[model samples]
Target: MMKYEEEYWIDYIKNNELNKKEASELLNLDIYSLMKIGDSLRSFDTGDTVSYAVSYNINYTNYCTASCPICAFYTPYKIKKYEINKPNKKGYELSLDDIKKDIEKAKALNVTEIHIVGGFNPDLSIEYYESLFKEVKKYLPDVTLKAFTIPEIDFISRTHGVSIKDLIQRLKEAGMDAHTGGGAEIFNENVRKLITTPEKISGEKWLEDAKLIHSLGIYGNSTMTYGHLENFDDIIDHMIRLRDNQIDTPGFLSFIPLKFSIENTPLYKMGKVRYPSSGDKDIKVYALARAILGKSIRNISVYWVALGKEMAQIALLSGGSDLVGTAFSEKVFGATNRKTSTSIEELNHLINEIGRIPALRDTFYNLKEYY
Candidate 1:
C-alpha cells in the first residue's frame, strides 16, 4: 500500500490533486489531524460562509415497485394493492390538486426550491410527471423544482420505453430544475447488489445518466448512503467515482454524505445492520469527501434532516460547507424515526453557533443572501 506523511497529503490537497490512495489514507489519521486537513480544504474552496436553501420536500407517493432492502419509506404496491379495496390503509399516490396545494403552501412560506422525490410507482406514467411539473410551474413559475433521483428517472425511462436523455428533456421542458443524488448507495457492484434490490440500475448507469444530464445544461447534486454494509474501501470507491464524473462533466452542484438511517429499514429488521453511523464516522466521511474530491466537486453538504442539528453543526466545522435545505415535509428520514425538518432560523443559528457565516443559496449554489 502507498504511505504518505501528513504534509504530503496536505500539499496534495493544496494542489487540488489528492488521489484516491491518499484520500483512503486519511481515514487512518487521528481525528484532529484529519479534521484540520478537511477544514483547511473547505475554507480554501468555499470560505467561512456556510450555505443553505429554503426548500420543501414533497414525496408525491410512497407506493413503489422497487422495495429495496435499504429503504423504509416505500410501501410495496404489490402487497398493498389489495388494501386499496379497504379504507385508508393503502399507499398514496398524490393527486395533481394535492401537489398544487403543496406548491401553494411552499410559496406562502417564500420557499425558493421545491424538492420532489418519491417511490417508483409503476402505475404513474411519464405524462404524470410532465403534468405535475407543468402545474408546479403554473402555480409558482419562479420556484426551483429540484426533483427525482437517477434511479427514479431510469425506472421511468424504461417503463415508458424511452431513453433517459429523452425523459430528462421532456421533464426539463415541463419544469425539472435538477436531479437529486439519492439511490447511489455505494458504487461497488457487489456492495450495491447486497444492499439494494436487483431491479435498481447499476452505479455505472447512474453516472452515465448524470453525465447526460450535465451535458444538457442542468446541474445537480451527488450523494452516497453510507453506514450500511460498506467498508472504508467501498466509501473511497464511491467518492472516486463521483470525483471522476465531476471532472468529466463539472455540473455536480454538491456532494452530500448521507448517513444511513437504519431504525425502520429492512436491514435493521433482518438483523443485518444495527445502528446509524456514529458521530466519528459521520465527520470522517464528510471531511474525507472534501479531501478526496478536492477541487473536482467543491460543495460538501451535511444533510440536517438525516444527521440532526448537533451532528450537522459538527460537520460544518469538519468539512461541510452547506446544510442542504430546509425540508418542510421530509418523510424519508421521518419514516426511519429520525428528525426530518429544520427551519431557516434554526439553520442560521446553527451555522452562527459554529462561528461561520450563514447564507441562503439557490439550488445551483448561487448565493441569495449572507446573514
Candidate 2:
C-alpha cells in the first residue's frame, strides 16, 4: 500500500474517526510502530482477568465438503494417516449418534455451551444437526446450541437444492441458535483467489450470506484466515468489509484474527507456515486484529488448538477475551489451532493462570453456567 495509507491507520486506530480506507494506513506501518500499535490494542478493555469456567467448544465433526487448501480439519477425499503430533485424524466424519454421545460427554463435564460446526456433510449432517440440537435440548435443556455457518448451509442447499434462507429457517426451527464464524478466512476476492481458491465461498458471498443470517436474527462471530499469503492490506479490506456490513446489522458478533498453520494443510506443503516468532503471521494477525477491531466487536476468540495453551494465554492479555469453547471431538480446527481438542477444565485453569476469567459463553456470547 501507499505510505500515506499507513499513517492513516495509525491515527485512525488511536483516534477512531477515520474511514476504513484512510485508517488502513496500518498497511504501511514500520515494524516498530506496528508493534506499538499491537501492544496498545492488546491492553484495550479485555474484561475480568480471573479465569472462569464460562465455556469451551464441543467440536462435533471432522468432515466437510469444501476442502479449502488452507484447511486444518478435513482430509483428502480419502483418509490420511497423518496425525500432527496431536490426536486428530482427518477422515472420520462424526455421525448424529456420535454427536449425541459427545453431547452426553460435554454435559457430564458441566459445559454450559456446545459450539458445534461440522463440514459440508452431503450425507445428512444437516438434518442430523437438527436432530442433534433437538436431542440436546431434550437431554440437557439448559445447554446452549450455537451451531454452523450459512456457507455450510449454502453448501447443503446446493447439495440438497434448497434455498439458503430456507435452510437457515429449518436449522433455527430445529434448535440451532447462533453461528460461529469459521470458513470465512478472508473476505477479499483477489486475496482469496491467491490463497484459499475454490473450496471457499467468495468474500462477497460470505458477507452477503452472513448478513442474511443476521437479518434472520441469528447472531454469529466472524473471522479472517491470515498468515498464509495475503498482506496487511488484504487483512484491512476483510475487516472493513465486516465492519461496514456490521453498520447494517450489529448481529455480526465479533471479528476473529485467525493465525495460519501449515500442519496437515496444503499451504504447509507449499511451505507457508514458518515465521520468526513461536507462531508466525497468524500471531501478527492476532495483534493486528486487536488493534483494528477494537470495541466494535464484543469478543475475540483464541482457539486453543492453533495457538496452543501457552500462546493462547498470552493472547488473552493481548486483546483476546473469548477463549473458544471446549471440543469433545474436533479434527479440523484442531489442524489449525494445532490441537484436536482442549478440555474446558484445562482452559479454565489456563485463563486463571493468565488472570482472565474463562467465562463460558454460548455461541451468542450469553454467559453459561460456570462449572
Error of 1 at 130 (Å): 1.0
**Best by lDDT, which number?**
1
Model 1 TM-score is 0.96
Model 2 misplaced stretches (Cα beyond 4 Å)? 1-63, 76-90, 197-199, 272-283, 335-337, 340-345, 355-358, 367-371
Residue 200 lDDT in candidate 1: 87
Instruction: List, residue by residue over 215-313, the lDDT tens digit for candidate 2.
Output: 988888898777677766787777767777787777876766666666667767767655523443444566566666665664667765666678776
Candidate 1 residues lying further than 4 Å off, grouped into runs, are: 1-8
Clashes of 2: 29
Task: Count the clashes in each prediction.
Answer: 0, 29
Cα lDDT computed for each candidate against the true fold: 0.86, 0.65
Best TM-score goes to which candidate? 1
- Position 198, candidate 1: lDDT: 74
